[model samples]
Target: MKTIQLFFLILIIVSCSSNKKISVNTSKQSLKNQQLIIDTDINTENIIVEEISANTEIRLKKDSITTVNSYITAPVFDSILKPKHDSFNKLLSMFVSKEGFVHYKDLKKRQLDLQKYIFYLGENLPTQNWTKSDILAFWINTYNALTIDLILRHYPVKSIKDIKNPWQQRHWKLGDKWYNLDEIEHQILRKMDEPRLHFAIVCASISCPKLLNEAYTAENLEQQLTNATQDFLSDSTKNSISKDKVELSKIFNWFNADFTKNGSLIDFLNLYSPIEISKTASKSFKDYNWDLNE
Candidate 1:
């Protein structure tokens, strides 16, 4: 009996040890599962934060694009300067009065309009094969358009030089750069170096050439520019060619440096002037009229 009892006790002790080992293993497995759950939760949180950040960046970019689209350029001419058919004439009309005067509220207002419209035109200008006349027409329109803008806001002065260091002011802001009226005239337009520009652009005064009632077209641009130059020279009040001395408008004197760059004013004039005149003729300056060119 004692031996039987001993064997049974030993068996009970072994069974208890086995149960303890099983409990330990179950506890370890439960801990591991808890840790995995915690790690999964952390990963989920990180993904949410990344998604939120991405959404915020997208919203900001969209807002920036919207602001850019709202911008416009200074419209000095409407249907009168650019053909309305499939063009931006309607948008151009927003910046000018029916009589062709820019609204002089402030620089910011003008800048907003100018920025918007220039971009619009640049984006929408025809891109197919174009003739020199087409290119010239666009340039002339741009020059006159910009000139009218400068005059409407500021005029009645003796000369464009009368402005008090206005060149420093940010007139036309484009592509992260600011351009003054002088740069537009001398650099961009004159660099093309076309003489017809002299007659196409106006300074908003009677002495300057008349602003064409219609926009210049590529088909007739060359003829138009030539006609403009001829008409201005023929007008006795503006320019008169004589055998001895060549009497000319103040424009020749003011912009004499431009003409004189390649050759003398007499030479430049002789290229277009029909009447015969000597190169050694006496050079005289004419007074400019400041009367409003209505």
Candidate 2:
């Protein structure tokens, strides 16, 4: 009887010990699992966002994006849809002559409309659902429109360079962030690996590629970029080309690397230039005209 009682006591103690060990090990494993997840901070303050100031009169089109500037931070509006360029196109067609010179005087007179559109851009930032073309068109339009807005704000300025630090000044904000032209052009657009952007994005200068009379859209972006590049290279004043010798715009000198990515600069020019340049063509750069395109 005594031996049987002792055996039962030993079994109970061993079973309790096994259960305690398993519980402790499981607790440690759960603690280790919890530690696996790491939390980090995203620094959006340093990211880029550009547009005009918030005082524009906004009349959001039905079923379009909301206007959220300084006045309206988290505005509630209809579901945001794909961006439409109709209004901007109308504005461009009205103010931009066929030759690409803008009537800044008339445009300034209707500054509210331009300002409204610019703020609309600030509010309707790109989304992941947007295609690559969508994003490209957005920035190109944004850059050009912002340049115009800058000029209109300081109307009667003879040159884009007249504005102190035209490309670097942060004039407006999107949400809590403010970005400049440098950020949009160099950081965003140029980094997209499209060299033709040099021709599509006008600098509000005569020597820069002529501004298109219509806004760039995603569906026709490819063709528009090609057309812009071709037109720029074909203009004798901008890029004088012969079979063996080429005198290019200083734009070529400044952004030569962009054109040379696939091959030599001549190789890029050939793709757009009407004339086939010789492999060993002598090259020179013309003086850039920085006078306002107005």
Q: Find the candidate with the highest lDDT and give its number.
A: 2
Error of 1 at 79 (Å): 17
1-294 per-residue lDDT for model 2 (tens digits)? 999999999999999999999999999998877665422112222221222122222323222234444433332221243467777889999999877999999999988888788777876776555678988998999898888989998999999999999998898564346878889999999999999888989889999999999999999999999999999999998989999999999988998889898999988888989999998999999998999998
CA RMSD per model (angstroms): 15.7, 16.5
Tens digit of lDDT per residue, candidate 1, span 1-294? 999999999999999999999999999999999999999999987886666555434433342322211112324112212332223243335544443333334323555455455554443242223346665677566555555556545644445545566444446544345556566677766776676687877765667776665566777777778877877877777776787776789888777777787887788787677776687888676677756554
Top candidate on TM-score is 2
Listed in order, each prediction's TM-score against the native is 0.53, 0.73
Q: What stretches of model 1 exceed 4 Å from their correct place?
A: 1-119, 122-132, 154-178, 260-263
Candidate lDDT scores, in order, read 0.61, 0.82
